[model samples]
Every structure is written in structure tokens, then in C-alpha cells.
Target chain A: METARISTWQFFILALGYLLGTSFFFRIGGLISIAKQDAWMIPLWSGIAGVLLVLIWIKLANYYPGNTIIQICIQVAGKGFGGFIALLYIGYFVHLSALITRNLGDFMKINLMPRTPIVVFHVMFLLVICYAVTKGVETISRSTEFLFPLVTVTFLLIFFIALSEWNWDRFQGMFHMNIWTTMKETRSLIGFPFMEAFVLMMLFPYVKSKNRIKVSFILANVVTALLLSLGVFFTIGVLGVTRASHETYSLFVIVQEMHIGTFFEHLESTIALILLIVIFIKLSISYYCAVSGLCQLFQVNNRSWLSISLILLVSGLSLGFDNILENIVFNREYYFEYMLLFAVIFPLLFLFLTWMKKGKEKRKVVGSQA
Target chain B: MIWFILFIAVALATSIFMMVKQKKSTKEIMLFSTIVLLGFADWISIFLERKFNPNHWIASFIDWISL
Candidate 1:
């Protein structure tokens, strides 16, 4: 178990930053291409669903206070099966971190450093992440406290600057797409940043002050969703839905479209800066969770022994997809179902088992007293 | 290709030496070596042009299951 506990505000910032890496860069771009002008609404809807699912995650975490999801699994389920579940959760953390790392790799290779191998970007970033993870979770969460505000402020600035090119006419044919098709196209989102919060259960127990943790989480989710919604709306409005839908990383496209004469052109760096900062925080949290989970399960307190190996493993797994298109297809088509197992299904199943165990304990107590 | 292999070898060697210096238990070192080696094998496969992509397998499974 982690000895260092963070304040509720730190938890809020970590969660907010994690969610705000704004998968919108990859996810909403593709979704807007699907839902067209009305796609911005998807983030809002996903945010609400994400908020409700987070309540379930918290309920499960509170049942075993001070225990991480991995620890909770071992306690609730027998060691053999519980160990499997714990490993699965650890795998989730590693897998998500890898996917995001690959996203950064792809982004860099395409936009900035075309000559450099994609693996180079991943290796450099993972090396930094390995250092952060070994320092422990408190250090990472505290760093997010400042980075969150910085990234959000710059994100707002970028949006405002891009407002020069915004066009209401871009939204002219709003709901021309079939309703059911739009819903199908966007359903995977709730599983994304939201159900993805399912992983945050690992960090919930380490929050020192739990008094307003739920409030902080809910507010953070809502704020991130709204910000991402604005991003979607801005992407469609500025670059037009047709173009943004086809392009990967629509947010970058919007920033590229931002021009205040030649003097203020090529602000790709600003948008990339925002994405990198927030994604770093998100990646750090997941990296920390995975490494620590491995340590606890194997009874090793020295995380440095494991962080480097995990970094190497993730870099290799991240390249498992040959192209970004394959990854996007997985995210859009099957990722929700895959995530559902770890996010909602297993958590709820464990919650039910917890209730049964509690009932049995109460019965034993009554018999003893009688 | 040879240079990239050397980079992997040097990285793995440095990391192992750091852990040994930190006096990590043998069991932990063994676990670390196993994972890092697996990672090394995968990376080498990619560079060797016999790339192995687990995503393709999962995507195909998803398609086959129609899920």
C-alpha cells in the first residue's frame, strides 16, 4: 500500500488532467467525421455517463479503503482468481499508457520529426516516464496540479485565437446524418476518457482527504467534457466537418488553420505543447499505477527495479499497430467492448461479491453475540 | 540495424547494472530481465522486418466474432 496520500485537490487535478489529455485529438476528430456538425454533443453525453460510472468506481473503492483496485481484488476474490484480476487491471494500465505513447509517437513522426523513427519518440518519452514513476505517485499528482491549469489556459488561448476563423455556416446541416448511426458512431466515447476513469480506482484510496473527492471528480469530468466539446465544435466550425473528419488529430488541424496574418502563423507548436503537457500527465498517472501495481503484487517496494522493464515492454507493445488507422479503428469499433470488461463489468461483479461477503460477516457477528 | 541493436543492448545492460547496484532482490531482477528481454525480442523483430503486431490479431478476432 502507498504511504503517501494526496489531497482531494490533487486527486481532482490528476483526474482532470488524465481526462483532459483530451482524447479528442484522436477520438473526437474521427467521431465528428461520423456525426458531422452535431458531433460536439457526443462529449457532453459521454461526460454524463462517465460521471455516473465513476460513482460506481468510487463505491467499489470505498469498500476497501486504503487498498488499491489490485489489493481490493486480492482481498475480495481468492488469491488465485483475484491475482488474475489484479494482473488484468495492471495490464489495462500498461495498455492504455502504451496506446497514448503511440499516439504521441505518431503525432511527432507525422508532424514534427518525419525523419526520426517512431520508436525513438516513444523511447525518449518512456524514459522520462520511468523516472517519474520511480519517484512515486505523489510526485506525479503534485506536478499535475500546476500543469493542468497551464495546459487548460493555453488550450483556451489557442481556441480564442482560432476564433478568428470560426464560421457558423460550417454547422449549417447539423443533423443530416441518421440519428441511430450517429449514436453508434459515438457510443465508444463514454468508454474512453470516462469509463477509462475506471482505472482511477487504483489511485482513489491514496487520496488523503476523501470528504469532497466525488465532487472534485464530477466537476473535473464535466469541465473536461465541456472543454472537449468546445474543441469539437471549434474543429468543425473552423476547419469544417468534412475536412476535420478526414484528418487525424483535428485539434492540430484547427491550430494549423489559425492565422493572424503571417506574423502569427504556424501555431502548431502551441496546440502540440498543450497536448504533450496533458498527455504526459495522463501517461504518468497510468505508468505510475501499472508500475506500483506490479510492485505490490510481487512484494517489491523498490519500483526502480520494475519501471525500466515496464517502459521497455510498453514501447514494444505500442508499436503493435502498424499504422494509426488500425489503432483508430480499434478505438472506434471495439475498444469500448474491450474496456467494458475492465471498467464496468469486473468492478460491478466484484462489488456484488463484496456485498455477499459483508452479509456473511454480519451473520457471523450476530451468531457470536447471540 | 546493428547500431539500433547496440542501443538496445546498452540500455538493457545499464538498467540491469543500476538494479544490481540498488541491491534489488534476485527474484525481482529475474522478473525485470524476463520482461526487458521480451521487449528486446519484439523490437528486434520489428527492425528485422518480421514485425509482429498483436493488434492485427485482436482486430481479426473482433472481425471473426463480429463483436
Candidate 2:
């Protein structure tokens, strides 16, 4: 049987999917809410934690090279039980995609199209996602590789544009926040977007080279951290600490005020289009992962049908949230911990389980040789 | 409105075709299809619950299922 494989570059895209989507819009409130005036510290702390966790994941992958998380679970925990764990992961992945779709839909509706029905944005986004998944991971990966340069350039351009309006008062008293608040926020910050890159474990089976996976994973986390920092810093500086929390994509508001001259004003729409492109790329990869995990768990012969099914399912999920307020409320209340369980906790647990299994297997081999 | 419904129907139909053509066993296909329908029903209920007051029975049944 032929197994579909993706190149190293695609793996990078898969990681980008996890980082760019969740962090892009929401990282500001998450950072400022915790770090207060010392928002930059949040990224530094989270990056340290993120890199360490990713290294743990890399070490596990090295132990069992070329196996997906589901495959590894089965190897470590035997067929029946491992398959059940894999099924649980499938549900987790599905819930994740639903949350992402719902959030993106909420953001787009509130920010870009107030008059147009929310379903319009939802359908269009999912339709594009469905098309991308049908083409397979390579398409999404290549698209990410292709657009990554533009996205980066646009991101930097926007960051610099906001720099002109920097106000240091928003970042004043950098370390003055109570230590407990900072530490608590630091833990929540670690999970939201940075450590969430742990989801890339599922894609480990597809990449050709197992060597240097750690280097790539750490590099991805660092780059993501820097981007998140840039976004949060600019948001706080431009919007001020108070208003920044209310502005979901506060970076856009800063850009709206920007003008090289009078001719270049009201730039929010252009920025929105670029972000829309980035979000779509992010969504496609994530939706693909959710579908692929399901296919593998069910042992389905072809996964393309899963993509089509997701189109409808995601469309519905996106609309399930009544508005941005409910979405935001749910995210903080339940979604954060829920995501950690599947994306972070389970993978870490599986890593430990795999390590124990390998030790036992090694002992058995040594005994036989003796 | 008609176009929207037709578009969704077409998407579901295409998925069904691809699902069959790919030769996935009926069980898997059915599972996927059921998820799609269930998710769609959940969304539509939220979309039209109060506006279509006459359909309270349908809404109540969906609520009972509790997605």
C-alpha cells in the first residue's frame, strides 16, 4: 500500500499553520492581559518554554523515527488500546479544526464584513480549504512556501509601519507587575500559540529527513515567537494598553492610521486582505491535519472524502458561535485547556509511554542475545 | 437562499461521490456523512431557531440531542 508523504518544507508549513493562525489575531490580549506593561517578556518566557517542549517532542520522534503520533501510540500501547488513543486524538483534532474555523469566521465577520452574512465568509473559507485538502498536503505546503515570503514581508512591513507611532508609556514599568500575575500569565501564554506547535508531531511521519528535526522545530518556534512579539508590541504601542484588548486585530488599526503621505491612508483593507490570505493558508493546513488524523485512525483507504465532509461540518461549526463575544468567552473559559489536552498533554504523555515501551523492548532483546 | 442550499447539496453530493469512488467501505462513508449532517443541523438550528417559531419541535429535538 502506498502511503502519502510530504517533504520537509511541508512539515514547516504544518508548523506555521499552528502558529500563524491562533497567534496572529489573539496573541495581543493574551500577552497584554498577563504581562501588562512588560508584554515583550511574555514572548521571551513562552519561547523558552516552547523550545524546551518542542525538543522533548523531537527527542521522542527521534526514538521512533518515521512514525506518526498515531502509529507511535499503537507501537507503544499495543493495537487495541493505542487505536483507542488514536481515536481520541481524532476527536481532538476535529474539535481543534472546528474551534479554528469558528474563531476565524467570527473575526472576519466582525472586522471585515459587518453587513454581509457570516455564512458567506464561512462557506468561502471552507470551500477554499476543501479544495486545498483534496489536492493533498503538498499543495498546502507549497502554497505556504510560496506565500510565506510574501506573508513575512507583509508582516514586517506592517510592523515597521506601526513602529512610527510607538508609545513607550504602554510598555512602561516593565517588571512592575506582581510576580504571581506574570507567572500565571506566562503559563497560559506558553500554551496558547507557541507550544501549540506540538501539533506538528502528527506530520512527523510525512517528512523524509528525521535528522535535524529539532533544529527546525526550535527555529520555527523562535520565528513564531518573534512574530507574536512584534504583533503584541505594536498593538500595545499603537492602540495603548487599554484599547488594545478590545481591538482583536489591533495591528490593523495601527496600520489604518499609517500614511506614507495622504495618498496612502486607510490601509486597513489592504492589510486585511493579506491577513485573510495568511489565515486561509493556516486554515487549510489545520483542516487537512484534522481530516488526515481521522483517516489514519479509521484506517480509511482514501482521505479525500474526509475533506469534503469537513467543508460542510466546518461551515456549520463556524456559524455555531453566535458572535465574537461568545467565541472569546468560550475560548478563555474552556477552549484553552481543552486544546492543551489534545495538542500538548497527550503528545507529551505518549512520548513518555513510548520511552518506557522502548526500554522494555531493548531489555527483551538483550536477554535474548544473552 | 436557493443557491446557498444548492451549493451545500452539491458539496455533500460530491463528497458522497468521491467517498464512493475512493472505495471507502460504507461504514466509514456513513460515519463521515452523519457527522456532516449532524453538524449542519446544529448550525442551522442556531441560525433559524427563533425566527422560525413554528419549528420549535424541530429545535427542541436538536437541543435534546446536545451536540
Candidate 3:
């Protein structure tokens, strides 16, 4: 038996890790920035696109029952070359961790600390992340199980509070833009957060019961898409296209501008804290995956050491961007392609190669039997 | 700033000490260290940048969609 056993609740909580990070926060801004007033449609279409990507993972998991992508790569390509391909995946995982961690840390700086050096937050955040990883995946899963409810409640509360400010008029001019342009912008939407469902592959192995894995995976994507769609829709409706386009914390701005019981003003700090917690959880999980993937790639018994190195590498990369503008520049031109390359293109190729190898093995077996 | 540097110095020292004393692999330490350090960079940047531009690709999707 595996040393760690995650109950159904824990798996569901763990799945939210997909939603809370780049997808929910940073990526939303990108989509809104592109789709503008028409951004709501992007998520609707992108959600469908996301479902299709998640299906690929489901089919792959079905074909290889009880095996991970790493194991499947070895089975298909054989040891030496298979290991090379696995390394590519490991590299992708690490890059993703760095990207997510950087984004989380970036958000913290913008929201919480006006004076605190970015490095301070980076060290503090990673200390917690490393500790969480060291405790292993089960501990994180259990904590997520508890924290998930609070995260959801916070989101719902914010959504409800901002509802009074909703202007149907803001959504009035939808699709006034050319359809083809909206479609092109939809690519950015599909690429950013929706395609991120591919990360489900790494987590799918841990989901209990073979039959439930695919179903649960699809359900998770649905939940994520719904939440994100609501967030973008509300944020756009309340803030209008102009403010929503450039606003970093658009939802929080909506909340701040919202009037309620007289005592409820200046609630953005609370919102910031809530987002921080969610994003931290996100970074930790991705960091853990990267570390764990590396250990598996090299056959290391201890992952803790790799976790430390990854923190430093990510920090250096994060700092290397100089400022937020530079970071955004890197993310746009470089990270966009990088996301598709890792999450979509590479995984599909792996699936195809595995299928071909399996077919060849069947033919060889039949020949021998004859 | 001094305190911050000192804290990082201490953490780095402890990490090195743990590295040598334990039979742990260098790769593992490197991975963890990169995560912490890079995570810090992210935190600092967000805190520092007040008016962060969300669009990086410089795409005119807003105009495109608005049109």
C-alpha cells in the first residue's frame, strides 16, 4: 500500500490548486485585456476548449491504467531515449513552478507590502512552500481539504458583495467587435488558464479509483471554468471595460468601490490576504510537482534537496526580470508559447507515440504466436 | 534591509550545513533553494509595482474586441 492515502475530499481540495493560481488571477487579466468588453465570451468558448484538453488527459490515463506519463514514456521509448523525453517533461514542470511561484510572489508584493523588499517575500513564501512540500503531498492535501471551504466562501462572499454594483449596461455592447478578432483573442484565453487543465495529468495518478479519475478530472475543469467565468464576468460588469483592462486587482477594486454596512470599507486588504493564501497554495503544489518530478527523473530517493535548489533557481529567475513590466514582457512573448509547448503539444505527442508503440508491440506478439 | 539579508544569509548557511551533514543529494537542495529564492522575487515585485500593466504581448485585443 502507498504510504499516503488521500480521501475523496482531499483529492477535490487538491484539484483546486489548478484554479487558484495563474488561471484565476493573472491569466484573467490577460484575457480581459484582450477580449475587452467581449471577454466573457472568451471564457465560454475557452471553457469548452479546456474541456477538450482535459479529455485528452482522461483518454491517456485510461490507456495506461495505473501509470504516470513518466512511466508511460519509458514503456514506449525504452530506457535511454525514454528517459530523455521524461527529462523534457521534468524541465517543463520546473519551469512551470518557477513561473507560478514568481506570479504568486509578484501578487503579494503588489497587494500586501509597499515597502518590503521583494526578496523578503520570496524567502518567506518559499520557506512555507518548502516546509509544506517536505511534509509531503498528503499533508498538503489534508490542509487543502480544510482550506478549500474558506477559499470558496471568500470567493462567494466577494461575488455577492459586488453584485449590487453590477451594471447590465456594461455588458450591453458585447460582440460589437469583429468576430474574427474576438476569436483570435480567444486563442490567448484558451492558451492561458483553460489549457492549464493539462496539469491534471500530474495529479490524475493520485486520484483514487480508476473509474472516478476521468469523471473527477472533468468535473474539476468544469468547476474551475465556472468560477473563472463568473469572476471575469462580474469583474467586467462592475468595473467596466476601461478599468478592468488595466486594473491589477480588478475584483478588489470593485469591492473597495462597493458600499455596504458602514464598517465594511477598505476590505481590499482582506481580499489581498485571501488571494495570497490561495496563490501560495498554488505555488507550493506546483513547486512540489517540479521537485517530485525531478526526483523521479533522476531516481533520487530524497526530494528535499531538489526542492531547495529549485527555490533558488526560481528566485534568480524571478529577480532577473528586474520589474513587473519586464516580467510581463517575458510572460507574453516567451511564456505564452512555453505554456502551449509544455501543456498541449508535448503531452499530445507523448500520447501519440505511446499509442504507436503499443500497436507495434501487439503486432510483434501476434507474429510470434503465429 | 540588513535584517533581511541576514535572514537570507542564515537560511543559506543552514541549508548548506544541512546539505553537508545529511546524506541528501545536491539536486534536491538546489531545487528547494531555487523555489524559495524565486518565490521571494515574485512577492517583492508585486508589492513594489503599483500600476502593473496586465498585457504583456502588447496585443490590441481590447481595441480588437471593442471594435
Choose the strongest candidate by DockQ.
Answer: 1
Between the candidate structures 2 and 3, which one is better when assessed by lDDT? 2
Model 2 CA lDDT for position A180 = 68
Clashes of each: 0, 0, 47
What is the Å distance of residue A332 in model 2 from its true position?
3.0
Best by TM-score: 1
Which run of 10 residues does model 1 chain A get worst, by summed lDDT? Answer: A20-29
Q: List ranges where model 1 is wrong by over 4 Å.
A: B1-21, B60-67
DockQ of 3: 0.17
Tens-place lDDT per residue, model 3, A1-370, is 1245566556666666666445666666666787777776666776787778878777776777766667666766778988887777776665556566666667777777767877677767878888888777788787777776777787788888888888888887677777787776456566666665565566556666667766666676677777788878888878888888887667767766766889788877776767667766677777777666666666677766666666666655555445666665555544445567666776687789878878999999999999
**TM-score for candidate 2 (chain B):** 0.63
In angstroms and one decimal each, the interface RMSD of every candidate reads 1.6, 7.9, 7.9
Per-candidate TM vs. native?
Answer: 0.93, 0.86, 0.83
Task: Tell me the TM-score of model 3.
Answer: 0.83
Please state the CAPRI-style docking class of candidate 3.
incorrect
Decide which is better by DockQ, 2 or 3.
2
Which run of 10 residues does model 3 chain A get worst, by summed lDDT?
Answer: A1-10
Reference-based lDDT, residue A328, model 1: 80
Clashing pairs in 1: none
lDDT of 3 at A302: 75
